[model samples]
Target: MRWFWIDHFVEFETGRTAAAVKNVSLAEEHLHDHFLGFAVMPSSLVIEGLAQTGGLLVGEHYQFNERVVLAKVSRASFHFMARPGDSLTYQATMQDINENGAMVAGTSHMGDRLQAEIDLVFAHLPSRENDERELFDPADFLAMLRLLRLYDVGRQSDGSPLTIPAHLLQAEQAMEAATDLN
Candidate 1:
């Protein structure tokens, strides 16, 4: 969670597919040190962007109740390096999801050109909290979703605005209260 590769989610469907975007810019520090005088978005960060898209798509099915983690990368291939000013769009489709884990196929594109394709595996871990808080605080997660404009524009398959679950809203309210006290 230290770095967010994706800038925002352009499309989100509960358990099916999601699309997100990331714009490579000259302002990013990592781009500078990656290679002296030659800046390109790192392949690893591109993979992470795809993983985030896939992981969120899979996790939404459980209502964010499970701790989802990237378990493995079955395959990842990039056709070309992305340079500054390039906008990358990532798409992930769910292959199959069950109680234990899920598999997803993701692809990235710069305009009409394919930049990368990835086959990923994700695992659901036993729930664990940090500092008496959930592994990922629902409030923080919701905030992230808001920042990504997911809730503002996300829609269900039937074309209804995606509503925030009651449990998550309650958790967010509690978090706000806790923060108020400190």
Candidate 2:
């Protein structure tokens, strides 16, 4: 699956909140089909981006063990259009978290302008019990976590690196080297 949102974590507080950003560019292919003449980022994908950012935050809380998927979005709204050349910063705060699920609230801003806001709910499922193992794997999973820079910031509430496994790190380096060649 292509990652629709490639995020950079600016700050993360274990079980509390996280801030991230996505740089929208004209070079993206979807812009061509999203609109004929006036390209704009679709609202659905904007929500997806928010979901992705929030999902990672929620998932990390479980140490990548519990599978968390976006279960619902409530009162989601958009105020402005996001187009190429816009750098959208997304900030998500966890409202609640339990064994069953998590609730998060987020806002997307293009510079100082509010672009969108959402209240998202995510459900946690055990990986062993999940039927979509092919869709999620330890390798790609860790890569995504690294790509989001989830482990590159402050320690968790208990003071830990939120470490990524060594094997995953090696795999990520290989992937990065391969991409660099292209």
Candidate 3:
């Protein structure tokens, strides 16, 4: 929730796949300290970007109702270092998904060259009547989706524009009403 490894979603297909981009810039503080003179985007951050892209895709499948958490990284292989000024494209494909969790296969590329390949598993937290903890604020999550341009590029299997889930919209409206009351 604090650090967004991916800049935005460039492509998103409901219950299928998603692609995101991250522009590596010299202005990033983390890269500056990563090395004295050699600044490269860390592989860990790259994995995070892939996880985020895949996680969002999986979460959207269930209308953002499930608490999809990255459970494991089954595999990862880095081919080359991504330097500043490189635009990394992360693509995540749904390998398998169910009520319990989902599996995602991901790849990172700089232009046509493969930068990394990773496999991830996401676990959906159990919903309980007694438990009311929310992974994210509905308003904030909606805003994030908007900022990421998910709706701008996302599409359903039938090729229609991805509609915002009713639950998310209602929650956003409720938050707005509460804010107005304050």
Largest lDDT belongs to which candidate?
3
Question: Compared with the true structure, what per-residue lDDT tens digits does model 1 show for residues 1-182?
Answer: 45688999999987888999999999999999998899999999999999999998888878777778999999999999999999999999999999898999999999999999999999988654563346577888888877888787677888898888787899789998999999
lDDT (tens digit, per residue) of candidate 2 on 71-150: 99986989989998888988889999988989999999988899999999999875565465534656676766767788
Q: Which pairs clash inside model 1?
A: none
For all candidates in order, the CA lDDT equals 0.89, 0.80, 0.95
TM-score of 2: 0.82
Off by over 4 Å in 2: 126-135, 158-160, 165-182
Model 1 scores worst on lDDT over the 10 consecutive residues at: 126-135
| Model 1 ranges with Cα > 4 A deviation | 127-133, 179-182
| TM-score, one value per model | 0.91, 0.82, 0.96
Candidate 1 residue 178 C-alpha distance from true site, Å: 3.9
- The better-scoring model by TM-score among 1 and 2 is 1
